[model samples]
Target chain A: MVKITYISHAGEARLVEAASGQSAMEAAVHHNIAGIDGDCGGVIACGTCHVHVDGTWTDRLAPPGEKERDMLAYIDNARPNSRLCCQIVLGEELDGLVLHLPIAQH
Target chain B: MDIAVSDIERARSIPLDKIDVSAPDLYLRDAAHPYFARLRNEAPVHYCRESLYGPYWSVTKFNDIVEIDTNHKVFSSDASVGSFVLDDTTLNPVEGGIYLPNFLGMDPPKHDIHRQTVSPIVAPQNLANLEGLIRQRTRGVLDGLPVGVPFNWVDRVSIELTTMMLATLFDFPFDERRKLTRWSDVVTTRPGDGVVDSWEQRNQELYECAAYFQRLWAERAAAAPRPDLISMLAHSPAMRTMSPEEFLGTLALLIVGGNDTTRNSMSGGVLAHHLFPAEWSRVKADRALIPNMVSEIIRWQTPIAHMRRTALADFEFRGQHIRKGDKVVMWYLSGNRDDSVIDRPFDFVADRPRARHHLSFGFGIHRCLGNRLAELQLRILWEEVFERFSAIEVVGTPVRIPSNLVRGYADLPVVVHA
Candidate 1:
């Protein structure tokens, strides 16, 4: 299991232990994390699963793909550190990942 | 049961290659289910050589529809090349038909910019602000209804609530709100479905709609920016300079997008509850199920039956050879019922898991902008409904609209028992 920290827009933080192969979205959804909707079931189609990766860990993750970038471009609160967590697969390499939820899912 | 059996029999009798699911009458009779079921079973990527709208390919399965919807690069919704509906004439006018160009029909870059301009109005913050008002209005409407007597739910409740919501969105004159309803109907209805007699008449009515909005636009434009859609469009640099046709198109899109889709779903929930009383009872017994039930209702209604896209270039999709410019209609109605994706696809399960995952809101960039707002409206409507009435019985046969484009009702005679 990989440990990840999810900080809400209100600064409330929750730590979850996600299986290595699953995406951050899958884990958050599995844990019934309040903010992440994962409405498209990890297809990167709906922008509902948007999150901001911690600056410290942002460099560890690969940049979003073309489809992910296009979907993110339309998100209301997207920023340079923004990513659709569905694209972020949990692994031993990113065991102590920190992510921030948006004000709300569009 | 007789209708279902006959529909299946008729659907089975037709040759696989000859089945055309675009006929308006099929939806009018609510008999399109068996035909779509056959398509999903036999030819998920089925093609019809001809129909009132002309030859088009129907993507019936849920995954196939998702694939096509997300791949906007290959399957374009640009109105110039074609349109987002099987009838291209609506966007590309011929003689009597009007040219209505809006963001929904445009491709990326342009579609992205224009869509972003007004999307904030339905953003979560704005929705939170509007929730109390929506709930209050819903209560008002519900309190006014005559209980234990059959009335057209479509007119009395669905139309009334949705129209009032649209009026609030535009800050449209409250008394004149029904005009928004009329304009929405005009935008979707073709000649002689009872809304208008001919395309010329439809055009005339639409121009009146345009004029009415233009008057509002002039006022809103001259004033400081406000929260209403008209004010936002007037103030936004990206939208203010839209062409007259584009202005009308944008208004039509917003009006219908905000109006008809939710209206049908409100009526649909009543119908679904009537058909599936057990599920309704489950919801009433637990108010927490309201949100999930809203999603179920939208899926069951599949308010906007199909969305069409034109292939940008020749491509092989799901092993079928689709040429450039071929009209591809993603049948959301069929996709929502695909048993492979949805367990017991026909039954309305209020607490169904992953209820938010459905095709009612088309996938990708052109997905419905007012989705959350629509959900808020339905949620409020049902919550208020439960507080007032123990049951809403379908007292008479529901008369469905005869259009493949809009799977809706003309009348649903219902009686609310208090």
Candidate 2:
């Protein structure tokens, strides 16, 4: 199992465990975590699952691709470290990774 | 000028020469697969310099569509961009000078505000409350189907169920619910077609629709705030003061948004079962697949084929020089079939992974508002189908809708064998 922490815009953190192959977005959606809409079901389309990876764990993650990067441009609160959670696949190596959610998922 | 050719015959005989995927007849005959396939393979972002809808760019690949759908800034869906369809309003304005400025046509602040006003109607709480009613209706529609006898599923099942739900959302007169469907059809219908013989008639019908809804608007405005869509629009600060055309536009948007896609999806789901019996059997055996199956159905059918947007500025896209004011069509139908994104894009697979990943409900701020509700309806539908019927067989080929915009069946003959 892979453990991950999702920090809401309000700064409330919720930790959840997901299967190794599942995405962080899928884990949040499955656990009903607040602020992670994942409306497109990890399609890399809707940026509703926008998340800012914690600085410490950012190095372990692969950079966003053209599709994800293009989608991120539409996110109102997108930052250089921001990533769509759906694009981030959880693995044992990145256990306990943290993601900060945007206040609004529009 | 030389001779008249029917769509079906032309579809069968046409060579691979510069295929026009925008041709309405190509879709009318349900023969757009090869055309779109060619586009995806040869030129993902090809430009059609001339067609019935005039010059437009076709973005056929999956990632390309995602780029356009997400970047609403450069690719604007403004009503002036011809209301998200190939019908170029710049070339020929809609008759009666009627342009409804719904949020789908607006950008940023205006779009967000307007969308928020009606968002609560489909909020999680409301959908939870609506689940029981939807299930009851689904049970009624399925249980009432004629067993072992051919019937029009499009009308008996799809239209009946979606129209009922639309009425519930709008709180329109229950007895006069069919009027909603008629108004929706009229709004999407093109001129010179059988739906409306002339543009004048279409405008007249829409005017009547406006007058009827105007009464409802006044009633809702007078009464205390309610949960119905009309009331939401009537009472909300952002929507309350809409111009007549804008009011009509919002109403049209709401009505069609609630009607066509869901209606077509219901029919399309049944047709999917008929087309793929093995997959249907797997889904029938394992109810867990219903949720994913619903997404696959929507993707396979792509009820609304393509949504048009206009280029706000000259830009480079996928190594192509797209000029300002070019009509760009994101062919959701073709994109859904993009093998790069979806595996075995042609076949209907019930257990397909990440099935909810589809372009049918669209993307970004303008993505479908009623998506969850549409899924709930379909989920309950298959649940009831499992309990009631053993087989819902297709009796005849579906009569396809003759428009490039709304890709759906007008008549789908089917029978349930218990």
Candidate 1 chain B: 10-residue stretch with minimal lDDT: B87-96
In TM-score terms, candidate 1 sits at: 0.98
Off by over 4 Å in 1: B1-4
Q: For candidate 1, lDDT tens digit of each residue in B4-27?
A: 677789899999889999998888
Which stretches of candidate 2 lie above 4 Å from their native place?
A: A5-23, A26-44, A47-106, B1-17, B89-92, B95-97
Identify the candidate with maximal lDDT.
1
DockQ of the two-chain complex in candidate 2: 0.24
lDDT of 2 at A99: 92
TM-score of each: 0.98, 0.85
Q: For residues A1-106, write the lDDT of model 2, one tens digit per residue.
A: 9999999888999989999989898899899896777766676767778888998788789888876876675555568889998888888998989999876565
User: Share of real interface contacts recovered by each model?
Assistant: 0.59, 0.26
Residue by residue across B1-418, what tens digits does model 2's lDDT show?
A: 1112454355455553456888877777777877787778778898887787778899999888978987888889887655577875311255433566788788776887887788777765688789999999988888787899999999998999999999999999999999999988887777754578776787788889999999999999999999999999999998899998889988888888888998998888888887788987898899988988988898998999999888999989989999888989999999999999889998889889778778998887678877878888888888888888888888887888888888888899998989
- Give me the TM-scores of chain B across the candidates: 0.98, 0.95
